[model samples]
Target chain A: MVAESARENKRVLEVKNLKLHYLTSQGAVKAVDDISFCLNRGETLGIVGESGCGKTTTAVALMMMPSPPGKIVGGQILIEGKDIVPMTETQIRKQIRWEKISMVFQGAMNCLTPVYTIGKQMMETLREHREMAKEEAIARIEKYLAYVGLSRDVLKRYPHELSGGMKQRIVIAMALFLEPKIILCDEPTTALDVVVQAQIINLLKDLKQQLDLSFIFITHDLATEAEVSDRLMVMYGGKIAEIGTNEQIYGKQGPMHPYTQRLLKATPLLHEKVEELAFIPGRPPDLLNPPKGCKFHDRCNVVMDRCKEEEPDLREVEPDHFVSCWRCRES
Target chain B: MSENIFEAKNLQKWFPVRRSITDLLKRRQSYVKAVDGVTFSIRRGEIFGLVGESGCGKTTTGKMLMKLLEPTGGQMLLDGQDVTHITAERLKTYRREVQMVFQDPYASMNPRFRIRDVLEEPLLIHKVGEDHQERLKMVARALTEVRLQPPEEYMERFPHMLSGGQRQRAATARSLILNPKFIVADEPVSMIDLSTRAEILHMMKQVQRELQLTYLYITHDLSTARYFTDTIAVMYLGRIVEMGDPDDVIDHPRHPYTMALIAAVCEPVSGKVNRIKDVPIKGEVPSAQNIPRGCRFHPRCLYAKEECWTQIEPELEIVEGRHWVACRRYKEI
Candidate 1:
């Protein structure tokens, strides 16, 4: 019991059996299905998958603000021993959201209002959340802006006045205004230019260390995710296909999950020479009516007769390395 | 005909910016130098990549090569013929030999048109086949060539009905229907899924090799450019700052801009997590209308000296065999 408490202390956020479904005209889209993971303090967990693979959905569900038609069907989202799943919407907004966890959304640069100055918009967020004076809030905003390598003058400028990279930095600063210990970044650097992307990635790393914050960095770009994540989680359809440290997933031993291995192979590399890039033959599964048994069974290169009949649970293949594959189970 | 299939010499495309009231009163005119004096030659059947970030005018260069946009200045030669400002009648013939594949397949194709109609429209425009039946046969053949087989099945489907990768393949098939000698593929795979990007690129590569077609592949992603192209030219502020083989340009980039770009690429290799990546250059790219004097990159260059901006802009000088850099301080850097 004492050991379990110590382990819980290290985890900043724990998600157990989290299931999110989107009700469409066709059917319920299982965007996130029974996924479980724990994010340790100051550790960055990178979630990678193709479009509609539930990377962004997972982030949104954690924030407890899944868009209309999307509902958190079942699961417990525990932050520092507090279960947020049972909390009401008003209660979650007041106590849970932006207090313990915050999110930097995909293409958040465009989220800034054009009518308001950067300072005014940031002040509104602070004013909505806490009882703070304008001067104190402005000072906090400036400090966080500086943390993201932006100058004080930016607060006076409108969203259109700044470049995409600068606007992204401002979004990051806004996420930090509440001083949340955990930040969920969903494709934060997706549309930015390469150089600017590197700068943003570096800034996130610096802030992670300085603030001692944990991050759920989600992106489809495997390389960028690999550059930021301490532990990598590869998701397919709506389930966790594989989860492990960078070495266990990307080292010479290679990824055990067929989907993860194929994804890594398909991604183009700069520093290495590849004679050919392997591509997954089929399209990503439609969540509305995903294939039977394993979600990735249709695209798996090393498929077995058993894989088609029974779904495999996420089993620990090595120490701290979990893979969901019937082949791994046989081995 | 010359061995070089298509050559662009000091090509320039400057779009005039709207003059303000003060500028009009002062009789001042400004231009967004989109493609400012870019010079390169595409060898026969070789893939030459034009790589740069957005607003760097790579797309403008591709448009000029395709004759979609008339160049404001400079010469464009095709098969030893100067065809920069060809007559409309001549352009029709020229376009038949030089096709273009755009970035977004969804936006590029007509939504109402079937796959058969999309491929047939080009053949009809170029007057390739004899009749309707003959054209349909050619369309089926083109579909087969792109490996969208059993061609008849795909031919009846609309663009929306097909998947992203399949739509791209259909787009490629449309471009190939006319059997163009030169193709300008501008960020063709950027809109597709990550897992399927390699498939599109591989099919494009296979088609390029089988048909012995020359391609001007334009993209902002260096990794894809490195994998797909035979030669690469790194552009900045509408100018070619570096040009050489993919190995030389990507592996041992000489220009400061190229070096910074390569450094910024997020390599998928493991064990690089949490490592602080230093993006050597600073500040965002300046507006194209207000390009810096002398060296266009001096504003953001880390090693910029007084002469870099004060002196005359450096021209592309041969560093070694087939490797060229426009940076004056390349040797020192």
Candidate 2:
């Protein structure tokens, strides 16, 4: 029990049955339905799925802001053993958001104000958080900027003056300014070119090791996810399809879930010569009117009749590996 | 007749930059060298991929071929006939022979029109069909070609009602309604979902094979370029840095830029997950307005030498059989 407690202490964040729903005029859209996962200290967890698969919703939920009409219906978001589900927006801003967990949003480079210099916007973030001297704040900003491989000269330049890669770096630098334990990056390198994307990915990896920061890296790009993530979480229809280590998820044995297996085959690999790439037929499920049973049953190739009637629970298939599939459960 | 269907000799498109007040006072003129000098040829029924980063003139080259943008200089030969300065009736005929599928299917399509109307409009423009009934049959045939099944069900639906993948298929159908011998597809699968990207590519390949149509596939994605195209040309700073078989150019890249691009691709294999990649290249692509005097890629190249920037620009030269590299230090590198 003592050893278990000690191991539990190493966990930075633990989510239990997290459910985020977007209440529409039609009905309540279960964007993130009853999903549970944990992020360990100094570990990078990659959450990957297709568009509208609730990956971004989960990220927003973790940050305690789930846009309008979306709410954390039920669940315990335990950060360092303290539940943050009931925390108010002001409370989250003061104590949790950016102070303990920060986020680098998709296309965040474009979010940088065109009217203001990069330094001015970063300084505003610093000023809003705590009571620090202007000199000290500037010094901190410069330190973080250097961490992201940018010089002090960039501080004087506006967002328009910088390239896409440079702007992304600046956004990453700002994410690190708070020195948060966990950073949520959503498609941070999607808009970038192949070479520039590699540079940014390398920079993020370097920072992750140097700072021992935990990350929730979300992207639809499987290859990029493989490069950075220590653990992989495949989400489909706002539910956990499979969660395992890189080896377990991408190993020769392959993923347990049908969706994951197909998704892996769908991605084109550079090293391997594939005669024909596999593709999942049909579109993603509509959250407003999700299927009766397993969310992926409509598209799953190995789907049984039971899968159309009952959703399977996320069960431990191996040590540190979890799969939510009737086939795996039956096996 | 030669196997080559389309050939471009030193194609160039230089857009004049609006003169600033300072430049106006100084009596200076400048141009954004969008496509300084690009040269390549597409075979009779081969998918020729023009791959590059954003400002590298791949799309501009495609536009020049599509005649969407007129080139400032150079020659374009279609089937051994010079069509560079063709006007009026010849241009319309060129349009009929060479169709273009744009990047965004969502934006390219008219939201107000049904899928049938979208496909039929092209036929009407080219005056390919005799009447509305004949045009409808052509539209159905085109839709069937792209695997949008039953044709009748999808014909009545608006663009907004179709999914992204379906819309892209519809766009492809629209491009094929005219039965063009050549299709200039600019990043056709980039905007679609990951699961559907392969499907769209597969459909396109099947269509290309069935119809024996040539394609000028322009995209920044090297992986898709490798999978989809027979020949690949790596473009850099308004020039063809490398051109060869898709496998040769991608797997055994001769040019430094191509090497960097291949190195940067995050392979999805499980074995390579833990491998830490040292990004071989440095800095983003330079602006086209102020291209370097010698080699444009000298600023970011790891093996760059003094002569790379101070000497005359390198031109495409044969490195191996059917493989070409433009770097002066290709042999040394």
Q: lDDT of model 1 at residue B24? A: 100
Work out the TM-score per prediction. Answer: 0.97, 0.98
Q: Calculate DockQ per candidate and list them.
A: 0.77, 0.70
The list of candidate 2 runs beyond 4 A from truth reads A1-6, B271-275
**Which residue pairs in model 2 clash with each other?**
none
**Model 2, chain B: what is the TM-score?**
0.97
Off by over 4 Å in 1: A1-5
How many steric overlaps are in each model, in order? 0, 0
Position A310, candidate 1: lDDT: 85
Model 2 docking tier (incorrect/acceptable/medium/high): medium
lDDT (CA) per prediction: 0.91, 0.91
Q: Write the per-residue lDDT of candidate 2 for residues A1-331, one digit (tens) a residue.
A: 6755776888999999999999989999999999999999988899999999999999999999988799899999999999999988889988899889999999989989999998899999888887899999999999999999999999999999999999999999988888899999999999999888988888888899898899999999888888889899999999999999988877788888899889988999875667688999999999998999899998988889999999898998888799999999888
TM-score of chain B of 1: 0.98
